[model samples]
Target: METTPTEKKSIKNFFAKLGPGLVTGASDDDPSGIATYSQAGAQFGVKLLWTALLTYPLMVSIQEMCARIGLVTNHGLTGIIKRNYSKPVLYIIVLVSYPSITLNIGADIAGMGAVGNLLLPGIPSFIFSLGFTALLMFGIIFFNYNKIAAILKWLCICLFSYIIIPFLSKTNWGAVLQATIIPSFEISKAYFMALVGILGTTISPYLFFWQTSMEVEEVRQKKLIVDKAVIHGMQTDVKGGMLLTNIVFFFIILTSGTVLFNAGIHNIDTVEEAAKALQPLAGNMAYALFSIGVIGTGLLAIPVLAGASSYMMAEVFDWEEGLDKKFHEAKGFYITIIISLIIGLLIQFLGISPVQALLWSAVLYGITAPVMIAIILHICNNKKIMGTYTNNRISNVLGFATLLLMLAAAIALIWFLLK
Candidate 1:
């Protein structure tokens, strides 16, 4: 079939409008995400392969709502919530989410340095962590929003190595296909824990705040005033980005299932563990490729973790925020980001296990996520705030379902821990 000129132009314009979603999706596969997926592949093999498929729609729907909220209101989530709800509500969210997100930033920075050390042996992880932190702080503080967006988009390409490396391995396509299609699982504590980790990593809370804030930033970048038409386009961009995100997630599990699962290596505590285990079955190239992906994702995720916290704090206090402004213009925003990086670097020097820290942060995020979702759902549906843009029945159903599932997961995790 021949394509029409209009269709071609539409495609061109679509690519041109892609920004927030792509970055959000790419950052979804950060170092912590890599560890979670790798652990899933190693421990359960393909048993939990269905999770990536199951979580896709939920991820898209929730993120789309967030993007929509930001676009329609032209305010960050915190700012919107602060206006709609009581001070107690706002304080509770900021207090819980701020520390949890900052801790996640520390974990990601630590992971980034650890992965960097893997790529460049003999270099200290602490040095790499501090150096990377400084670089990120400087980049975000000095660079304009356009430059930061460009850098992030380019960094997303590093994820392609996962796609390439999996193919190089001697994979059993037949088994991979079967595992992906059939959602089989072993009934055990370990398997259950891995499932929680997978869910926590995939359907994360940070992505929610980051995605919405980025949508506002996107509109600001294009100088588009917030209105119905603009919000509609922003929602479209978000959906497109989420679709790309889930597709990459599907492949991450597929690659891990084929390479890590097939090798009978059931324990993977870190990204490096997954990489090392793939050496015999996937060859040296596989290790190198996986390491590269981790490095790229680490770079992408750390900034987001730090930035999201900064956005939350700045919004709560009515301080200027957004990369679109200069340091003098957004002093509080820039300072929040710097403090986050500094604290994160300082944590690396505390002799804590980075992997363990990442795991605890994931658990904390799981616990805090439900509260944020509740506030988001409530605020988004408020007629006075959202006008006709309030979530429709379908959106509410999906959003509520996500909230319930996250709450359940948190409870289950706590129960499991106590036992």
Candidate 2:
């Protein structure tokens, strides 16, 4: 009954392989992403399933570029941008990202609190959200990077609940397959907006900074700063994480498509609504599983959202930045973290629907994503910055294509908003 050395080695190797990429992918399906996917399924049903299939490769490719830049270069994405780009451009970048990240933080807090209330019915969401905000600040400000990573790795497991939900419900796999392989939707403003949201939540701009910075952190952890080691195993790691992310996205869509849409419930504007709707279709277990999953994933995601913003600001101002450092060591860095959380919490108190805010946060990301993606492509391909790490033909093709795709989405979103 005792485990052999080979088994233990395999277990150790399996865990060793999952690092930044895994955390990045897991963080992608945060509360906002969940709300977006839920809305897509509840409103459009199987028609939008093709998006998950399409974005899988795009997500992996774009993230790998960011990861490569971080691994090869000595600075984070914004650090590179600040050094090379104009100050006006830098200000513009921060201004654009400001609303998206901040709104997302608020919406995510509502989401985490909403799920917490579901699990602990005695607590009101307002109180729960405030408590959660305090908990997140304490953990990040006091805990070391290693401890935070360890905790996030465990929370990542909750996302698989979505994968389980679809199997519990009756699924028309034939229809699901057809929709996934072949896109079937008209060209309308609504459709364009939905497309934008999907892309925004999937290949988001915040992810670019977080992944890049984390890769640089990985290098620092291994004492490879002087060696400037060529990263060998990260592609596999990133790809595996992205694959899991897309799989979660796909199933969440499928679950709603099968359960909510089929039941003539087409609108899901809140986490509570979605949870309530899931009960009869997927049963009580699925409902409870989903309720807990969002809370856990929210815990994991909130920091990433705050960290991405903090990292960007720290790099822009040239302040000492890193989750590795304590509050005293990086006062501005941790203060930014506290302020971000406080602002997000305040937004939740305003008379706005949390789920709607979550959805709109994705829309903002849709608008901002193209601008960042273009810069990322430029930064990753520049020979001066990346040196031999410059993107190859495949990476370039996919990277540029991702930029073009997001650009088109941004343009479409603008044209519709104007009308």
Candidate 3:
């Protein structure tokens, strides 16, 4: 069973290639996403497992395009939009993104705090939320981008906790496999809403901003030349990250589908609820591991939510920005991030539950996703911008499909709300 030197080198090279893409994709499975996937499984069992399969390609295609745009343009998505698109368009994108990103930050912070309190019953959740926010702010402000990126890479290991949960309980592998391969559906408004939620969570505007900005950072930090080999490496990283993301997504749903649905606990509204429900059914180990994952994902995601929003503001206003820069060097950028964290933390004090925050964030995400996707598609395909690195035929096909899917999901979400 021992690997040869060639195999060892291959594995090492694979990991070395994984950078911004890995962090970006791993952060996608934040506490909000955990709640969504858990709710899907609890309500419909393995019937919705195929969503993981459905979203993988779409996620990879869209994110790869974003990464490529960053590499080619040497600018963040917001800056690109500001330069190429109209002022109103840029403002609208920023306006929609601000609340959505902040809401997500608040929800993630609350989820982590609640899970932290679950681990230690004596502590108040709000106290834990405040402490985490402070710690994140300190690290982001003091530590350089390289250090933060390394920590984010390490945090991705936490997602493996969910992969182990389903195994702790009894799982019908046959049914799980069938559900994953063969899609199923129901004709209920709730089902559609859940479907939309999953889509919106997976293919989000915040992630688009984060991915592009991080790629720009990666290029600048490493001084990487954007050639064919570099592009291929980025593609590999994005594929690996997104593939890992969907795997985690698949297992979370599988765990809740088999464990909670079978136990008749169908309403999972939050990450803490999902973790707590597993304790009696799947044992304390499962509960503890799930709780740990929630906290870890919150750590991984909140910075991304706050940073993505900050980067947008910086790029739009031409403020000196980068995690690599010192506090004095990019005061506006760091201040925006600090302010975002503070505002997001304050949101928890407004009597809003994490689930409610997620719902509100989801609404904004749905409204803006289609517009963002359309813009990304336009950018990736525009020869004048991408130059020689324009999206190929397959990329265009997948990109357009993603755009259509999000558009339809947005319209459906609106219809559901109206009803």
Candidate 4:
């Protein structure tokens, strides 16, 4: 079955249209996300697999709104808030966002380093962490936006490894189908906590900033006019990206649920642990693929995390900023990125547990997500800001639904934490 030229051209065209959305979606399943999904599958089996299905449309709606905001205003989410909203509002948003995003970066870097060490025992994990940090810094500062984006785009293939891992294991397709389509419920604090973490991970504020800014960057680099066609393309890219994200998520859960849970290996705390556990149970191939995927996703995600923070800071302070520009041209932006990576790397040496760091980050994300979603909805609906690009009725419905859902998740998380 050889592909014809027409099929090849269509496939190429599909990938060509996948810019910001594709990369963004791929980045969402970072090491931290992999760990979360792994934990869910290991601890609860396929009970939570339905979340992957549930979050798809919600994610698409929110991301589409963010992309639309970026296309219309030519500014990142932070910039839009800074311009139209009050000073304290913007400051509060930034204040809550930095720690969480930085902590997430740290956890991911640590996960990557741990997995690197797992792959090759001779090298110390910190050495691998340092090497990766330096590699990311070099690439981000030295490479232009187009090259870096292409690298990230290609890195998306790493997620396919996860998709393949499930098939390597003896997965029960009927059980997986039942878990995916039929929603499951549990009345426990831990269940709700995991649910909150998954929600926070999937629909994050940092992603909102990144998506909006990347769309602006896309338009500027290509000089694409913001019209119906452009908006439609952005929507398509976002939908494709989010669909990819959820599919990878589902498969990861399926792999762990079928392999680890059935083997009585529950409670996976880290990506490395998940991989190591897979080796003896599911075989070496599963372990190797999972470990490799962690590193690849780290490469893809760390930049997005650092870049999101940098973009937010640059936008708030009105500094010259862009991944498209040279480091010298956007010193503040590049400096913020470097500082984020540095802090993230240093966090591992501070004796903080990666699990605790991830937990706190999830908590912060839960807090900020609802507020940001509300603000985004307000911005997208405000005629003064969006003009004709204001969200349609369907968009508004989905947008508000996402807001209420996150708000509920946040409240539930807080209640459980205090309990």
Candidate 5:
């Protein structure tokens, strides 16, 4: 089992080149994602497991396009959209998307506070929420890109608890394998809603903006000039990152589906509920594992939700922005991040159900997805911006399909809501 020296060097070289992809993949497992996977397994069993697998390629394709655009053009999505598209178009899209995103961040902060309370029963949820929000804001404002990325990377490692817990549980591997490979469905409105929720959670628009912006940051971090060859490397990095993300997602569903569903626990309103339900079947280790995953993913995801919204706002308004820049250089950008975190913290005081807030946020994301996808496609295909790196025939085919699928999901979500 021991590796040769040559093999060891190769492995080290591989890891040395891996950066942005790992971060992107890790962020995908945010607190909202943990809630979605937990709810799916608790309610529908493993029936929706295939969705995780199916979503991986779609996510990779969309994110790779975003990374490519950022690396090739040396601009974020909003900057490109503002320059190429009409002001009216930019105004309408940013107006609607920005507020919804900030609202979702608030909901995530509330959810984090609720989950934190479970971990530390003596702490008040509101205080913990507010304190954590301030800490995150301060970290982003004061820390350089390397420090921020390092902190986020460690937070991401916390998600691996879910992977370890599944093995400790008495999993029905035969059934889990079946569910993962085979597609299943029901005709009820609730089923449709759940489907919408899963799609929204996985193919999030904020992630697209964040991943693309991070690529630009990565370029600056390495002090690399923007060029065709470098852009291609960025695409490879994106694919590698998303691949890791999908692998983690698949296992999350596998663990929850096997442990929670098979036990006949059909409803879970929070991560704590899901964790406790696994105790009788999967033991104390399972509970600890689930709790740890929730805390870790929440920390990793909250900043992303806040930061992405900040980047979009700054870019659209032409404010200087980037984690690499000093505080004075990006004052508006840092201030916007703080304001978003504050708004998110305020939601905890409203006494709203975190689960309900998460559900509604997912629905809102589902509704907005189509419009964002349309804009992303237009921007990526524009030769004026992308130059020779514009999306080719295959990219267009995949991108178009992704857009159509999201549109259908959005329409279906609306229909279910109306019914």
Candidate 6:
């Protein structure tokens, strides 16, 4: 068989467009995200589906801004902050964020272990957590950026299980369509909390760091990287990725809303519970498929958590960083990844529930999401950095709107806690 180079190049070019945005978007549906979205559907049904619609454009604009920062300046988010901002400001960001990141890594690992326990009887979640921890660490430490990115891009397919589970259930598409198009408000503690969780999981602060740093990595990989191809060209891919992100977001809520919520099973206390709830309504095959998603997304996300954390520290401390860098060349960077995972694993041993760990991790990130959004807007708009590449009128407007939405969520979260 004779194959044309042009045909091969076209195929190569198609895959080339996928990078940080696709990986970051897929990782958004990590174990915690699944639980949160499941809980949202079980507890409120289609009530909070609008949050997906609301946050989609907001997240797209936000991530595109991050992608630009990395491409134009050739520095990670923290590196840009380190150079422009005070040391006190930089350290404060890291100190506050590091624990949350560690706890989340730990929670995700435990959740992955729980999925293991579900699939393999007689193996406890705690034991599975330990094994998953080692396995994830091995991937991050051993694999280069190209290898890691390639693996994650494929793993993105696992999120389709969440998408498929909905189809298996009985959905009231009329109500679903109405709820999605015409927003409804619920004035209650649970509703606000769920809203907060949804926003936190979607427009995550760590995603900004991961997005910018990976773009920097992309630049470093191809020294002659075209900003047009890699930066501005990212919007099409970024939009596609984020739309997929929200579509999965929509379906998870739809699945649980149709199945569990309708069955009057509103109290989905954990990922395992969510999986179990699916069976009675959607069948064993649905349950099995859901559990597989849990494992798939967990494996896909844990590295992003570890890598984003490591990239933050390495950039801030001026230590060598990047999954592209070999282990010896980036010892401190790699060690930080190990340290985060270890500390994350220790949280499980400390008698903390993985479900609580996951939610609390989201809340912690939710608190700071607005602040990070503000900083990102400032960075991208500064002509000193972006030059003509600065965010245009449209970007600035949407970016600030996202900031305002996040600020309101943070404030509402506080009001709920205090009351």
Off by over 4 Å in 1: 1-8, 225-229
Off by over 4 Å in 6: 1-15
In the range 1-419, model 2's lDDT, one tens digit per residue, is: 99999999988876787888999999999877887788789888889989988898899888988888888886888988888889988888887786678888898899888878877889998898999899999999999988898888888898999998888778999999999999988677766777777887898888988999988887787656423234556887798789888999888888888899889888877676788788877789999988887887788888988998898899998999888887888999889889989989988788766765765676677777888888888987799988877788998888888888988877876677678
- Residue 146 displacement in candidate 4 (angstroms): 0.4
RMSD to native for every prediction? 2.0, 2.2, 0.7, 1.0, 1.8, 2.5
| Candidate 1 accuracy as TM-score | 0.94
How many clashes in candidate 6? 0
Model 5 lDDT-worst window of ten: 13-22
Alpha-carbon lDDT of model 3: 0.94
For model 4, the stretches where C-alpha displacement exceeds 4 angstroms are 1-6
Residue 323 of model 1 has an lDDT of 89
| lDDT tens per residue, model 4, 101-154 | 999999999999999999999999999999999999999999999999999999
Per-model lDDT: 0.80, 0.84, 0.94, 0.93, 0.78, 0.85
Task: Give the winner by lDDT: 3 or 4.
Answer: 3
Clashes of each: 0, 0, 0, 0, 1, 0
Clashes of 3: 0
Error of 3 at 186 (Å): 0.3
Off by over 4 Å in 3: none
Question: Against the true structure, what is each candidate's TM-score?
Answer: 0.94, 0.94, 0.99, 0.98, 0.95, 0.95
- What is the lDDT ranking, best to worst? 3, 4, 6, 2, 1, 5
After aligning candidate 4 to the native by TM-score, how far in Å is the CA of 299 from where it should be? 0.2
State how far residue 360 of model 4 sits from its true place (Å). 0.9
Candidate 3: give the clashing pairs.
Answer: none
State how far residue 246 of model 4 sits from its true place (Å): 0.5
Best by the TM-score measure: 3
The whole-model C-alpha lDDT of candidate 4 against the native structure comes to 0.93
